[model samples]
Target: MLETEKEKVKKDAEALQLKMYINGEWKEASDQKTRDVINPATGAVIAEAPEGTAEDAQAAIAAAKATFESGVWSDLPATERAAYLLKIADKIDEKAEELTKLETMDNGKTLREAGYDVGDAAACFRYYAGMITQPDGHTYHVADPMQAMVVREPVGVCGLIVPWNYPLLMSVWKIAPALAAGNTIVFKPSEVTPVTPTKLLEIFEEVGLPAGVANMVMGAGPVVGNEIASHKDVDMVSFTGGTKTGKHIMKTAADTMKKVSLELGGKSPNIIFADSDFETAVDYALFGIYAGAGQVCSAGSRILVEESIYEKFLARFAERAKEIRVGDGSDSKTEMGPLVSQEHLDKVLSYIEIGKEEGARLLCGGERLISDGLDKGYFVAPTAFADTTQEMRIVQEEIFGPVVAIQPFKDEEEAIRLANDSDYGLAGAVFTVDGAKGLRVIKKLRAGITWINSYHPTYNEAPWGGYKQSGIGRSLGTFGLEEFQEVKQININLEVEPIGWFEK
Candidate 1:
């Protein structure tokens, strides 16, 4: 039955065309070009998506712009807009199985992880739907004769670019709030893993999202992403990707002075103090960097251990890292799957070599793994490096792979310093039993999100983003809803009086 279910999912995904959705219609690229969507697990072509160009992006932008300006969606009451989002959430839940399979097949993560991501995507939409109806704006009274009010309104058409990792979940992080807040959207899923987002557009279509309200254009970053960022019609650009791309988007969007929110790269620290629950810290330390094959932007790739426990922890961690089961995504027993693509696999492997060249000791499992009858898939064993300095590239840079750099610190001050040493400050974790000490360490960490005694757990209700080069603005929570909105203030005069000082 398990094999049968797997076969069914594989069939369904292959049957899909993976086309773009623009102006309420499924369509191909303007030039009629297509690209193969490869399954990273097997290096097979699971489906084909449009190799969209700037012209295709223009169409999507125009659709979004026309829809927003039409006010068909934008003029609706917040509750009315929210109802549609709630339905999208429901639809997402209904199609969870199919979406999960496509996601796993496309991105090469375990099916279990993909399913969780699907559930999170649904929850994200629901969270925004409820938030949209809550009392927004504020009223203030200056005097008996004067009153003032401030209201939140949508920021016109928005452009959202999500990374290949966590494609659907990240897309929902931007799409849900943008839609619930009454803004139309032109969304670009990473060309590398466009399957689930393609599936999401199908759901949007089935749920009857208004024509031109939401659009999908799939292609390389240069063509699709660049057009969306620089397009005059798009009012805001929200991107989740590398810091370099985020910077490019920021600069491009600046031509029109558009609002830009970026959730970019990270080299976050996982600090394991000797005072913490030893076993729990060890487990999470592995989870933090190994989960998602460390493609996650908030991945705790830099681990700082107290000097006393450093050697002991390193030995245990390396031994456990070697035990991780890496195989095909379809295999129920597989703990980790392939990297997303051959290109990414090569990039990660190169980083491993660079880590060695930079003098970081490879404790274990730095090379690619090919086994279990899988030769073409991109698989890397979870790697741990010890005897690392703060200045080493492996410690400082954001290497988005299942490779972690372990360093030892003398005390609390040194740990804090090491954690804050990187240019990326997306997320960090502090493991300590003493509540006051944990809190103190958290306060000193420069990351946007800090976990105490845990790592890599995020809630839909909590804002997610980063500081420094880890990207700007926040996603999720009420703050996320506000990201797509513009605040407008109005003043009213209760008394019918004309100001003599004003020349009428």
Candidate 2:
């Protein structure tokens, strides 16, 4: 975050011009306008991508539609599609180190976290590759001469809008499954962070994915994203971002009656019981909200502890949070990095002020961090508040930053009540030594994914989604592949006996 660091990143930025990929080639925006890509850590311009317009988005959609209808890739054997996906996975693994560094520089996340994202992206591609080779439908026999079977088919061209939190990982969450289902893609990466997605397009080209089968267009939400949602040629839209934007996309895609899948915001809860392991619970509580500087959609931003241990746990948690390393993401020792942008940093700081106005007690870390040469970076200290009520905005809303609120509950019933009082139910966690108690609490929590004695540990094989306002559909497993497919029932007659059943 020093001047020299900014100069170094500026030099790197000058070497690359991130362009849009469409119709098997890289090009500029239709208007030839480009936007600077910033390194959040140093507040430096690291690269530039096209400020694509509606025309660019439409072009990508048209290319995908043509590829899907032409059957150049969609009609190929499932195993062959799997082969291409597997090769992409390998390529991702090959460039894992470089991609990690790029992600760190581009998104202001620690290099360690970026490495995990890269690894997860590769695993997601490989997971979908295996899924595509499995049987796809079910056969049914109806009494005498009737037979029927249901088969899954591609849902034509898909529009994918990914968020900036996990730039490459979120893209793979959609891209891997969409490709495995033999559907063409027109993807729009978050304009704030497009470097990794641009690199992903290079991998796609190197893997020999069929021409026009996949395209990447980078721009703001209203221009590129809305175009993808409302374009008539696009048959489906899969979006991951804030709840408001997801709702807008759903409404836009409704014009064409397109299939839609969404993964939105969360105000997740992490409830710790008196019977939980003290040390491990404390560690995971930190990991839940502090990792990625709490930009994750499923961050356990609200912590509920049993009244008996509330004071002790909160003290330890607050002390540890103050010690979290905040600096340039390229540093291996840095545990947390800057917020993704100046706007987001401001938003998080405003919420901290709101928390104080609501009379919530700030135990530690309520101000922006400007120390150890991190003055130029948009850094915020990991903040925690206690004596917060469910009605407080700090406890009820998705701060989406390194800010968390802790509340105490009287009993198990009250714990569940406090956890489910929010409008968002994306994910939650329970920390208890008793297995039966864990099951009881988890079954009652209204969340798509819940962890026992753990938090934020997701698997590639599991169905990832939320129950209520969190999302409309699932991703990351068999359920994810099904989202990109359409079901059709075929009927046949085995016996055609001449029995004057109908008057001819």
Q: Give the deviation of candidate 2 from the true structure as CA RMSD.
A: 3.2
Best by lDDT: 2
Clashing pairs in model 2, backbone N/Cα/C closer than 3 A: none
Runs of candidate 2 with Cα error greater than 4 angstroms are 1-15, 497-502
Worst 10 residues of 1 by lDDT: 1-10
Each prediction's whole-model lDDT (CA): 0.90, 0.92
- The clash number for model 2 is 0
Model 1, position 368, has a per-residue lDDT of: 82
lDDT of 1 by residue, 52-121 (tens): 8899999899999989999999999888888888899999999999998888998999988899999999
| Residue 368 shift from truth in candidate 1, angstroms | 1.1
The TM-score of candidate 2 is 0.97
